[model samples]
Target chain A: MDEQTALGLIGDRLAAAGDDCAVVDGQVITTDMLHERTDFPAGTTRYTAGWRAVGASLSDVAAMGATATAAVAVYAAPEFDGTELGAFLDGATAVCDAVGAEYVGGDLDGHDEFTVATTALGETDDPVRRSGAEPGDALCVTGSLGRTAAAIRLFDRGDIEAANELFRFTPRVAAGRALSPYASAMLDSSDGLARSVHQLVGASDCGAALTGPLPIDERVDEVAEDDADRRELGVFFGEDFELVCAIPEAELGPARDVTHCRLHRVGTVTESGVTHDGDPLPDRGYSH
Target chain B: MDEQTALGLIGDRLAAAGDDCAVVDGQVITTDMLHERTDFPAGTTRYTAGWRAVGASLSDVAAMGATATAAVAVYAAPEFDGTELGAFLDGATAVCDAVGAEYVGGDLDGHDEFTVATTALGETDDPVRRSGAEPGDALCVTGSLGRTAAAIRLFDRGDIEAANELFRFTPRVAAGRALSPYASAMLDSSDGLARSVHQLVGASDCGAALTGPLPIDERVDEVAEDDADRRELGVFFGEDFELVCAIPEAELGPARDVTHCRLHRVGTVTESGVTHDGDPLPDRGYSH
Candidate 1:
């Protein structure tokens, strides 16, 4: 039906030991998904491609509520020399450090172009998965969306604000950990709110309805070339690595309770097919 | 300096933990280096380019005494159908089956080319590393080399042999595990014998002497087009996932006694530097 659904079909055939040092270990979660391997060339500049590369895998571990311990990022390019290769390594090392992980070991090969993928190992007995959400739970977001998307728009144009806020986007680790104890069915909003909503509903086999206003920050509008720009940043664009956790209905005022990332109750999971204000919503939002 | 020595220079700055699950609990040994992210062309063939895309990484895992546990491979290409995409997946899955690993998770994206790079997870409580070899230890090898290099030479010219045993080469897993107890410094003849020999010495800080003749299997004649084929196969080749193990002098022949692989006593570790007899050997071989 969608990427995750399609992946679920395949993930069904594969199984490994419950314990692994990197991906199989309970401490870290692993994926060889489409998004995880693709390198956003834009990430090469502002935050640098290396950190984004390590961050790509670290974010997956973070989403699982695991604190990254070590990581091995494999980088491949056709003919990268000493200086260019050094920048890529530096980029990855910086992200590993900021995220509290270290580079242990990996391989390096020259290929057609740049593709850096990482396998991060983290530690935590408790992992926040994306299937624990209940139908009546209150939907809570851990951070703002549309920023990285905005950065993608302004990247080439040298828009300082978008590059400052978006390209250097950080995962809400503290907020994620804080919400891990109370929230359920946590998934990173990398694809978009629409696609993430599809994941929330599909994984739990439930539906969601968006009622309240979305958290489109003012900074998104500041970087917007037009009204469609802000809307695109808010809905369609991906790479936000923010967490969307389902909390109990009683703990609803997400903005007041959350500190590191702003939270908003944009929707509710339902027993029937999903809808936005009594209208059926799309079955999937993970864009191509 | 050798690759391992160069790696040590970079590995010096890395911070690591001692826990078994430190990187992924119970990891005894890891890979040499991870290639940077590589973008591939769209719709590559299942039995051709796609297989090599995954083989490169899996061979790295085989280089260590450890067995590959899991792999995460990704692809980024423009407008590939689900089936062509499935071929890439099939290639990766075949490697997993061959190596005793599973395809865990990976990423996918639509881009300019069909590039795939995989990170393989392997495990063994006591792995054979390059630093364990000592002077007076016998250098041994499993399987014949240069066929892969020869396969490339013929394949490039469209002189397809009925069966390319070299191109469809499987990593020597059973032999590696069987010899693990005796293997001091172990790795496959990946970059080439010349380079691998130098790698063993540089990392262990000992000299090596290539004394015996190369093990030229009958398969070489089957694939060779001319007499110069021996030279083509021996020097400058890539992708031979055969183990080159070092064992103590007392255990050398006996160690060779226990495998189906073509094990040969190729050389001995020394103190004067890597040499063919008493002459110093060069570290150049397969460039890729």
Candidate 2:
């Protein structure tokens, strides 16, 4: 999707995963547990762009298969620094509204470096677990991968067209929703492909393969001609809000409009664990 | 109102007004907004104690007539350099359970200092809002105050007794719940008694007169008696999670046994504005 769509969808009424609030039914739901839960994804930098920092967390709630409601944004807005607290608020409010959430209430503080803590709560459910896939399931991805990684490089190099096309991502909510009902296991591919495959194997007792070159952007191929370097596509970067679903091969649907993006039948669900050809794998997955 | 009582309530559950996870109906809730919504009583001190820093935000939610559900805590845990994540989690979790909330989920990061953020959510017909007070209502307070300030001074003097009584505080959930039915206005005294009264009056279009001193611990009185200048019951110094509620004088009987702390009849709500003796006013009662 385009930038506006992505921003709008994630900004206002988030169903859930990450962020300050996820809306549920007629009431608002949120939390305040983000201050000290730091044992995972260590070293993730906290940006000083106040609301954007908040958007970062709320987005995580959305990725987790839930709906964010209200939020308590405790941001350290430094004093006398004309750093546009207004812009930060606008961006944050935009993200909240895009996701269909509300800014219920919050507090502010003054500090040396900018630090933001958000607590978001979502509607109730036994959260769709990461360990529910079975053998004989087909491995599928919601959208293309290589694009985001490619965009990172392009953006850094000032390739604005390609960067905008690949970096401007809209969360796969519809696809995630559609596949969620049919898939045995699911995950969000914030980390790259090889790592995600390893995660699925660890949780569901399976391995995946590369039946074809990854769904690379046409722009990427045009630039890296005959390079045969798919490493960038498989295991290099992060920040792709796509879905990885495990479904039975027999129940998989025929070709449809979702074809705008490619979905590859990459591998098999095995009891013996991860393998490509006859060899066992080495890495467990992505580090972050 | 006692030190251990507040600590026992959050017993291992860091649900103090500024802990890691706020306990709500037996669940822990936190979010990124916690970084933005929390405040430190004194200005610019490196947070050396993780539990105390975490308690500030979690307790704020508990005061808002809600409970903790799940939390996403983020921190730079320099304090846990060689310690197991379990002890840290234990301290954070104990506070979560103290308020009847639990830690369901979160994210983690590292840094130079020990910093934490907690986000909590709870339930109600609607929150017992501060904008509900009316003229001629009873100005009531739950629990004691001036102890935290005393505790801070004790921390400076290496006096464990005052420190013990001061830092450990319980959110007035039971009192908030009990008073919810009859409260015309509600607020938590996080800033200070005078500030809290002014806030309640400002929000509700009425004024309040705190005719009597807040109930300070006997040890605090002993310490204050030694320093004539420090004898003010409640003016400056933060971290008191007592509830400041406005209720009709006629309806106090039905609230028996429901309050978790001592309910003090401090004064009355006024139609014109709040005042102390002939003083017109100074601070909005308190400011950072």
Candidate 3:
């Protein structure tokens, strides 16, 4: 069983499992857990771990187009390091400041391995959900994909500096707020564009058909080996914390004009099956 | 370099680190992470783990005298087991329901070992803080203490049934709500009575003096060997989720009258030092 199956036991009362955040009494709440072995690359700094762990969850808050408010973390490590923990808090505080949120406080415990679980809170007048797509809505994404995939490849190849620089993603908080008024359905592509599309389609009961060349990252082309197709890497290798949105055709112009984010018109939501390049989109994407 | 020292680096902007939950804009948020190896004794059930994890944080919420609204969990384990996961959710939902809160969904991931991080959200018109105690305030506790210590002993002796029964602690949600209006300073006795008093004193800039025999568990006496001092176990073993509060002497009767929870006035807040039976109290308790 995967996370989805385990959560299915919670029954239908819960909002579906794949949204950026859970809306509770008008508060947008989201959590992310970063296990050092799985989430932190070999050369990952404690600062980066804190920033990315908290940033990843803040990305969810941005996806909901809510005003970020507060965050708390749960830290578990067998042996505590004062300087490393200080760096981690600094990183967390920096990210929250960048995103207009507060790193309120958190809990700490001792465990065999280092792990950080962060929860972000946000407020919204009209909270967005991932299940509101219409047949003719424009499928849009906030930023370029494939950078994280390329960063991973770089890290694996010992290009630590380049990897760390490329991996630092700026959450589109301002753009999310601007688009919230217009977005019919929206989610963050933290799980890769392909899986995000699948999730959006599944949640909204609508399909998407992409048109023309995909927005492959420029860095992917420069760093990737021949085996790494930029498009495939962009689609399957996830951790792209960009907002994937479905906005009505009429509202797209306003959404574009109001936001400074690089908006990519990827496709259109359909009444039926999902397709990319006029072919059936493969059922593949990042899982964790 | 403990959690306290690490959090101290975050500085004074945050509410002090030792409180059960941090208050932000009238919202009380707290998190607790349970590592399977250290937290779950042998023969412990997944249901109990889930219940205890969420309940632990809820106890924090109760400590703040806030009305809990929601809870989210981050579950990480090497592999997913459907039955165990379901039981966990069952335990979580049961507690939320019992406390009049919603089990808002959560995140799940895979990790090397089993770990569950739970965050509980609450709202309060008059949120209680741990820094409000005044000299001459009565030092009170909700329910009895040393249950968890006794439970651990039972678990060590292979009495799983008694241990499990003892482990199911009821967070004083209703009682907290009632006491919020009267509590001068309040916190949960999660870090043992001794540590809690020390923390309350530290936060409130006051002291405490225990009047008599501690609220030792009757079960501790039943199961303990000759060397087992119930008072020491009660004051030092920790994990008692009872709320420890300081209410003015004039308000103690009203506070007790307003809540159904058993109120025990064990001591009084002093101007300086902490003591038990006219002797200086030891500065010791569970750290995590």
Q: Which candidate tops TM-score?
A: 3
lDDT of 2 by residue, B61-92 (tens): 55556554433355443333323344445455
User: Cα deviation in Å at residue A282, candidate 3?
Assistant: 2.1
How does chain B score by TM in each prediction? Answer: 0.81, 0.75, 0.96
C-alpha-based local distance difference test score of model 1: 0.62
The superposed Cα distance between candidate 3 and the true structure at residue A48, in angstroms, equals 1.3
- lDDT tens readout by residue for model 3, B104-140: 7787889988889999999987778788999999999
Off by over 4 Å in 3: A11-18, B11-18
Task: Assess the local accuracy of residue A15 in candidate 2 as a C-alpha lDDT between 0 and 100.
Answer: 27
Residue by residue across A102-126, what tens digits does model 1's lDDT show?
A: 7664555555556555566666777
Q: Residues B41-90, candidate 1: write the lDDT tens digits.
A: 12225444445556666665665666767766565556556666666676
Docking class of 3: medium
Candidate 2 Cα deviation (angstroms), residue A42: 21
Model 1 chain B weakest 10-residue run by lDDT: B34-43
Cα error, residue B78 of model 3, in Å, equals 1.4
Q: List iRMS for all predictions.
A: 5.3, 13.0, 2.4
DockQ for every prediction shown: 0.32, 0.16, 0.63
Candidate with maximal lDDT? 3
